[model samples]
Target chain A: MNWHEAPDMRNWILLLLLLLEIATFTFLSGVRFDSAGDFTAYFQSYLGDLITQSTPTLLLAFGMTLVLITAGIDLSVGSMVALVGCIMASFPGNTEFWWTAVPLGLLTGLTLGFLNGALVAWLDVPPIITTLGTMIFYRGLCFVVMGDLEKAPFITVPGYEWLGIFSGVIVMLGLLYLIGGPYVYHSRWLRELFMMGGNRIAARYAGIPVQRRTLQVYTLIGFLGFLAALSFTARNSSISAGSLQGFELQVIVAVVLGGTRVQGGSGTLLGAFLGVMLIAVLEEGLRGASIWGDTYLPFEISHLEYIFLGALLLIGVWVSNIAHQRSRA
Target chain B: MIHGRLDYRHRRRIYFLLAGNLLLLGLIRVLLKEGSSFAEVLRRAGPDVAPVILAGLAMTSVIFVGAIDLSVASIIAVAGSAFGVLVHHDQPPWICYFACLAAAWVLSMWNGYLIRTLKIPAIIVTLAGLPFYRGLALIVADLGIPDFGGNISVYDAAYHQPGKFYAGWILLATIIAALIWEAFGRTPRQWLARGNSEEACRLLGMKPERILQSAFCAAGIFLGFAALIAVTRLQAIEPGRMLVGFELHIVGAVVLGGTNIFGGEGSFGGTILGAFFLYFISQALTYAGASAYFQEAITGAVILAVIGLDCAIHRRQKQLDELA
Candidate 1:
């Protein structure tokens, strides 16, 4: 068979690339294994750190995949998450925050998301424009609520710290990816989203209630944003107005790089998982590879993330387009 | 019938902007204090607003052709980096300015080139360019300056002249030229044709790719001027932090000007008005003594309100057309 007709080649390539990246960066960072146990210990800790750091991104990526599959985007994801954190930070650090701040954060997230959905669904504004406007709008609201202050009520909150740790976050990710992923993958809703992304007017003609679905998809993103805020604030123990700046792009890039379509119609939860891992690994590797960068590179090692991100997005899109063409052919 | 082709919505948007700007000026005049200078405020508005209008015009061209360029802010940052690098090396002021213009122009055309050759969506190509160029800017800055601080300071009077003195003139010159060309130019009309329907344009033997390329080329020139002014206006050039959220501001202005986000419609004149209208809103907020933090929020709220209203008003018509 022609290479273009190969089944699921990109995923395999990504897996190989992930391993290659780990090996290269591990070498560059000069990690030595004292024993087999030492190696296992290091990898375990590294894997845990990666999960804790990427919990928010992975959660939001699932929502973003669903949104893109419905032919929409949520550029306001970063701002939405930041706003929730900022709102929650305003409450006292006592147990009351769990009841008051957490619920308020949830309400704010849903309301903000519903606003985006209503604008796109009822008012007929484009998703990009609506979210772009709300991105700035919500960020501005964050500043308004928090001012120039940085708040860390989560640090004092009882039992909230576990959300940032390996075991707690791992369980959450396991439930989301393992259980929810398969259900969504097989559900009728996913098929409807695929149709809507493929052709909105046709889906409406097919009685998919395009408007309601659009509303639901965006509102669901709001709930995800709240969850992301929960994990982020718990892990960091602080919140600021401008936290998670450019985060939406990161998630979008990861999801898109994972084989999700930018123009919508088709995406995979598995691809999103791999894509986020690919980026997360690259970021972690680069952070460790600063020793090499200090001698050989003039710019900060972290800056390379943006360059790699762009390249990876392009490569993924190329893979996707080839697959798109093969299907058409 | 000078605007004979403008639909009712676009026309109302123009009128609304005109009245809005005038009302804002009036409010500013009222809010003027005894010690403060209203005339100075009016004078500052020209140069202050030039970069935005130029960028808006650039956005207008690409958006007119049904494509969006989300990377122009990063392109400008790269231009600023080039300008800073040249200045740091003791290059002539002219060389620095020219490099700034050329850098932005080249990157923008490169975007068009990629989209044309690769057949990727313009949004994706530019969106990729967003961070890609930002990293490029930082690397270039890191490479150029010996002791690369985060920002490069230009202190010379000569270097600052373009942004400080000639911004208004440059703005006027570009606006006049762009509006005239837009009114009488076959090329821009071809862009509109392609934007409306690529397949139709291809069937008619007009190269949609070439037209799309032209839109980017035109956008590049406008963006070049915008970058030059914006970079020079700043005493310290920080490519990393400069124009962080500027892309959305340009999009807001373009959409407010009645350009369809998906393209196939809009005007330079409308974009100018929309840019001015947004500027005036912030100015009005300032004159009303709103907090600095509140201005961004209010500006966002205002954009949402206007766009929301415009879309709502046209929703019925859109639904009717879909049914038709």
Candidate 2:
């Protein structure tokens, strides 16, 4: 009945949904089974690829989780990542990438994030409107920088491709979820964030320094966006002005699916992690089932991804609310 | 009479929009080639900016009741797909137009109902609707038409009449009707009142929920026209890509017109001028030979600058009130 119990119960539901998804997709994709060992190997690689391919989304979802916890949304993360990637791509792909483009990309991410923070915190613009404007502005800047070009400098960077692989993603996930998440779970700072989200006016009156927290949260999203850009470019090996379109929605949906309330006040890092995997699994599963879909369905199998994503988001929120109300009742 | 009829707050915004409109007009006139007449520019304005204007009007009501519909673009896509499918079947113009308008109206009303009944925030509902409607459009297209390609192209000139020729008339008539309604009608004021204080409206025997729903219905009517013009103007209806990010432009225009983003105060005249101001800025950039890439950046900057300035100007007053 308490907050702690409510989330755990929701997590159980999510895990069950995730299991159902995996079962359905595995059957649809028609898993090959020559032997037990071969089947295990196939499953392991499939899972690894899903996680690795979704690393950027996972990293951004971590930040988005915290942002939504503060009752704010960042609509510019996609544009921010694209801008950072586009900026990094302007440099040559060589050993010098470490010294030249990497730091600059971080700074770009920080500066852009700070601008969003300032608008929302100091200028008092609503987070959604401010980010909406910056989203277009940053995207436009990407076009100006790249000029309708796609750059693949990331592929030529020394050892950079490692970051896009399974091991690198696993390391990032370990740091973010296993280590950093627990650190946040007990941190007074995050508690203060929840307080602010619950009631900004009361928190301010209670000496929470609301503006500073707002600025910090947005700036944090920006920093995470930089990391996301690194993972994305390293994996995809290409950057274009139009890259990562609709990516913010994907991250938000994943976090929301993981049981983070959009109204803020409560969230769990583990929940977001599960949420991202849920979507990633669905995506990869759909792609894997393309043959089956082509034979059975009337439309492209991938087209169903959009419908599923939307439906799952609505259903997730709807289910979570029902659970919340039942607990209170 | 005009001075006596308006509040000091709205009077200031009206004057500001008028000055901005004049400035943009002069800038455009200067940028045009030597022989080009101002009349020619004006003539093209209505059709070119009809969609944004109508959508802005649609947003104004929803915003007036302190809600937003981010799914307008997606709704337009669905409507456009329906229109396209009908056209592909060689349906009469009235049937196609009716289908398009009906789709948009029904979606808007559905959104309103969902927001009311589900007790969810409009933003969250519509954020979900954004993808849901887009995917729905694609599904509708796929199921309705056999041998569906990605796009449905309407080659007949007759189908384009509403967008190409009648758009100007539709826009003008709508503006006049909106102005008259805003000035004298009860519904618009009810929206503003509900926006101003939902609790107070309830205390006054007004149902805020019903008021919000009515605002959405009015918005749906405007959105129907917007979808009609928007779809007709396009030679091809590609549901996957149709009207992506169109909601931002509408929001920008509505905000630029001095409509409160939180609702409670706005005018149709201001939205009309605001939409024109934005259109002229892009047109001026084209005439001045600015790079195509700069158009979006300029528009974003302009929206940010206007909204930021307005917010800053009011911040001191808000702070003063808080202190009091």
Candidate 3:
């Protein structure tokens, strides 16, 4: 059975999302026509900030896509980010601290992720319950470590500034694309995650190392969380326990929107990337528009965005089900 | 011979459940402080926690069927907001109460339909509903009524009586409904079946979709009543922040009460006691001067501990059964 026969509707969704975003941007930018230069400048700055702001979520989503494909979730990623960010921002004043801090953050993330893997894979705990418990535990630990205080700028080293902006995001994305893109698309071990998600018992009976793969996937998410935290803190120039609060939800939404089934198996990283971009751009477009732009939609911008997201998520699943049914028929 | 064996097994299960409840209560008592009046602590914790226990039970019913409703808190918010809005208009208290309940039920049914028709997982559907319903509550609150500015106080006799006394009656009614369900209902049976193995249940002539829909509907009614209790207790509703993080507490209570997270096996008695135990623990911990942060951490740990213990017990029971 060629699984690739499934209709690649992710491209269409991405196209539609992007078109809507561009239209919103165009219309909203038109509102300030009297000051064209100011509008253009503000738009550029806004776009820059949006890209930088979205980088961390994008990174997290990239790793999350793999985990979801394996039919597991990494709730501790958000806490991992906060913890790593705290560590990065709490580096000693010495210039040599970057070497220690970066490696230490990554190590911490890996260890935590591995622990999650161990609990679920080795101890036979259910993934949802295990991650749910760790989600709170890790967050509480971060609070304890940081003493509930926000960490100040500690990464003021000469070469560190490059990790915070457009250039940094591009480099990081490129590295991930190089390493992960092929590993998922070409490698056999990696492809087993898809098969495992499709049917765990079948995969296990086929001699797949389900437990080991689960461990590896969670560990990857932890490392990505570390990278994301490093970049996020550098961009923001500070760290706090609340730095990445509720981010796991955003990652899940992106992964699902990008055509990754929440039930696991059958997804692409590119789709996840587009999903993150779509949400970020939608928010940016709404903010550009003068229509209740001051308040974040659900809480502040505009409640319409959430409604739109909910509708899109429902529609995506419905369409996918229809497609599956039709293909079977 | 079969009847005797079944009776023996049933008695054993009851004994086991009772022993678990007693252990939990004893743990709470010890944790609170020895030599203090345990009866007094229970009495004080009872009324203070009556509403949460009611709401948690409603949530647990849905969870037992292997579905979750994250929108319970949102329902509470909207119900409270609607009640406040009606009272602000000088509407009769009875009308406001019924309206709030009706609104919650309709919203909950919408959740049920979304999950049923769309085939979306409960977690995703309800996560989306959480914010969506909260937004509705906010909008309703924003549109202030004629007499009152933006807030509705429950100082009036009509509201206070329901909030204080009748709300407990609603909880008692829920317990009765659950008992009736356990005793003579195909709905609960189907739910358990679906939770265990949907495919197998389907092969066995059970319509999983219909059973799930009915389960959600029942859960919706319970949630509606829970929302009423919340509104009456709060007297005023700020839909924006009402019952934030309340779903966690409900799930924690359900799991602590001995319900399997994977679904299929649990008892209402265990869950009711679980709710009481959780409330008592929180009160006792607070009384012992634990900070809010520590309380949250401890609560999370307790949930993990309970689930872990349940898993261990379940595994051992399975092993014993297999040997037999």
Question: Per-residue alpha-carbon lDDT of model 3 for A1-329, expressed as tens digits?
Answer: 43324435546657676777777676754555568798788768776777788888888888888888877777667777887777666676457767888788889889878878887776656677767767766776676567667776655666676788888877897788767687667989767999988887678778999889989888888888888887887787778876776677778777777877777877888888888878887766755564544432223344456556666666766776666656777
Q: Cα lDDT of all candidates, in order? A: 0.89, 0.87, 0.72
Q: Ten consecutive residues with minimal summed lDDT in candidate 2 chain B? A: B1-10
Candidate 2: stretches off by over 4 Å: A1-5, B1-11
Candidate 2 C-alpha lDDT tens digits along A60-112: 89989998998888988999999999999999999999998999999999999
Check candidate 1 and list the clashing pairs: none
The weakest ten consecutive residues by lDDT in model 3 chain A span A292-301
In model 2, pairs of residues that clash are none
**Better TM-score candidate (1, 3):** 1
DockQ of the two-chain complex in candidate 3: 0.30
DockQ of all predictions against the true structure, Cα-based: 0.73, 0.63, 0.30
Expressed as tens digits, the lDDT of each residue in B1-324 for candidate 1 is 338767778888889888888998999899887898988988888899999999999998998788889999999999999999999898999999999999999999999998888888888888788889998898899889878879999888789988999999999999999988988888877877777899999999988998999999999999999999999998899988899878878998888888888888777888898888888888888878887778778777878999999999989999999999
**Which segments of candidate 1 are over 4 A away from where they belong?**
A1-8
- Tell me the TM-score of each prediction against the true structure: 0.97, 0.96, 0.85
Q: Which model is ahead, 1 or 2, in terms of TM-score?
A: 1
Per model, how much of the real contact set is kept?
A: 0.64, 0.50, 0.15
lDDT by residue (tens digit), candidate 3, B1-324: 212322343334445546655775676677766577878765555556666776776666677677888778887887887888788778897899898888888887788788888777887788777767776776676555433334556667677666676755667677787776766776776777787788898899988778777777777777777777778877566777677657766766766665666676566655677777656556756666665556555665666665655455566565466557
Query: What's the ranking of the predictions by DockQ, best on top?
Result: 1, 2, 3
Interface RMSD of 3: 3.4
